[model samples]
Target: MLRLVTTSLCLYCQRAQVTPLLLTRPHSVIFQEENQLAVNALYDLSVDISKVRKLKGWVLRQSAVYVSETAALLRDMGASGPVIARVLELHPEAILCNPDQMEAQKKLWMSVCASQKDLVGIIEKFPASFFTSSSDHDNQKANIAFFQTLHLNKRIISKLMASAPHSFSRPVKQNEEMIQTLQKTYLDLGGKEDNMKIWLQKLLTQNPYVLLKLPNALHDNLAFLRNVGFTSDELLRLLSKLKGFVTELNPESMRLTLSYSEETLGCTDAELRQIVLQCPALLYYSVPILADRFKGLLAAGVSMEQIMETPTVLELTTQIVQYRIQKLRSFGYDVRSGSLEVLNGTKKDFEMSYGKLRLRQERPLFNPVAPLRTED
Candidate 1:
């Protein structure tokens, strides 16, 4: 079982020995023991009943009046109940933490992203942002420098940090070792040093969790793609275009997705590779979504070859494909054979081409000078 410990409790446990009753009993069974003391630590906001329920652990020791001044600070700064609840869930000790520690966390959040609306995005992504320690602060600076070496700007780095604060929570050396290992592995795979930097930057900037991915995952993705007919040159382009390719992709699922697309589109594996090479994102789309678009296009009389030529149409929504195709067909135009322009042209552009925009009728504007006092 994963050893669950609150950030503050972990610090305390290190210095002092206390086994504290373990709530090892599955959470569902806990309600039967209603007589057992409930442990709710965070303070200030009224918590959700469900949240109150998740806070079920045996009383380690009676916590003193735990004031989450930091949580209060966020509420003061426009954080809502859900947001504060998430903060507590991610770091239960945030409520028990010293005022200064909470302040540092709030400050870090502002530094990374200040907009209250934006806070929901980052906080939801990295709730552990409020758990920074002195060493964590030092490591954060070093981590920034390390990412900067990959040519990421402060804004992107801030976004990355928001998304994966806990990933970079560990010491900087651990991350450094991982990056070095990845770089060496890429070189061993016959990747060019200059190109490897670009690919690595693309991957990490979009999905920093990929950095913490199982060490063999990168090699596996590369090998898997190559075996599935991605040529060496095409693989570089694939990595360049699909930033989350390595981090988010699953090998078995990708093979299934590829096979499903090939069968649905009535294309051979080579033809599938051609379209995927044109639009790398095709591989990322779920099989159902891919099928929906493919059948919609087939219904519109768009040949498989046309799809292969206009790979980007696969990226468009089913509604867009159907709407554009129907609109063009109504106007006696060939929706199937037309280039991307058929699918891409805006409504205004269509009106302009149909000679409607310039001729659009509107009520005549009256002279503002009281019609020059001419009643007639």
Candidate 2:
């Protein structure tokens, strides 16, 4: 009897252990079926399955119904098949969004977009922008309303939504503070009220991301420039040239670049200011890049004075400078003896200069009074 009781107890413990596995087996199979179905649906859409697997495997675990639903909504919105596939592939998280949330997002976007066709185009180009989290929907709506109150063009608002969506994800107060700071800075820098609205619109159009920057960044950069001896008029001009990118710069980085440039060019404070004014890129390019460019010019027998006279040459890469130098040398127009201005411009400009030099070389320095006879 004792042996029989011990055996029965062991059997009961074994059965208990097996019960949970038996219960979970069906659920695991259901998940696998769902994942496989999702994968098959996406594969049918011509999405690059290998990329989705590597970058967003979680998308497979989502319900196949959601994937199909999202794709169907995009199709209904006039998105082409390829565009829908590209959108899903680029932003797999979009599959997790529910139907109502997507509709709400679509409606919000349509407010700024000129038409459903335009909205579809924006979505096709910037899929991630259109598929932002539902939690940001309120903030996005608020930001759009605020921008409209500022009298910004619908086209500009559309661009901001597509290119700088994160700017809309923040609280309206954050954006409002930044805008107020810009306005104050403009007026303080001698900008007139009549031109402020146009100035703001142009600046925003040039760089919508500027609104994302901290207000203090603009303040600090302007203060640094003022300390560097830029008068009110000159500061306003520099701001216009930078196109609101000054907000992206901190005083520390500008100080470092200015110091390095002053030391490298061996110029006084006033002259350094003038160089920066002439070529805003001096404030933008990194030290190592600037060093390499200066080294390349000096290595090729170009004088520092020539670079000072034409600061824009620093914008060219070392390889381009070398290529242009060689091309000029082949034409007997040595850059060392000639002006560095010859090496500064687009490929077309360089080619035009080369063609003119070639013509000059082919022409006779002293033509006789008689016209040269052509062979028939």
lDDT of 1 by residue, 126-202 (tens): 65564554457656767767777877665677777776776667777777776776677667656888888666776
Residue-wise lDDT of candidate 2 within 1-376, one digit each (tens)? 0011112111211322322212356446322323566677788889898888788665554432357778888989888889888988887767666666788988998899888889888887898798777778899999999999989988899998899999998899999999999888889989999998899999998998899999988888988999989999989988988988898888888898999999999999999999989888788888899999999999999998999999999999999999999988886888888898878889999899888888998897886887989999
Instruction: Write out the backbone clash pairs for model 1.
Output: none
Q: Provide the TM-score for each candidate, comma-separated.
A: 0.61, 0.83
- TM-score, predicted candidate 2 vs. hidden true structure: 0.83
Model 2 poorest ten-residue lDDT run:
1-10
Once superposed on the true structure, which residue ranges of model 1 sit more than 4 Å away at CA? 1-68, 71-96, 104-128, 131-152, 170-174, 185-199, 263-270, 286-289, 317-320, 323-334, 340-376
Number of backbone-clashing residue pairs for each candidate, in the order shown: 0, 0
* C-alpha lDDT (0 to 100) for residue 191 of candidate 1: 81
Question: What lDDT does each candidate get?
Answer: 0.63, 0.82
Model 1 lDDT-worst window of ten: 30-39
- Under the 3 Å rule for N, CA and C atoms, how many clashes does model 1 have? 0
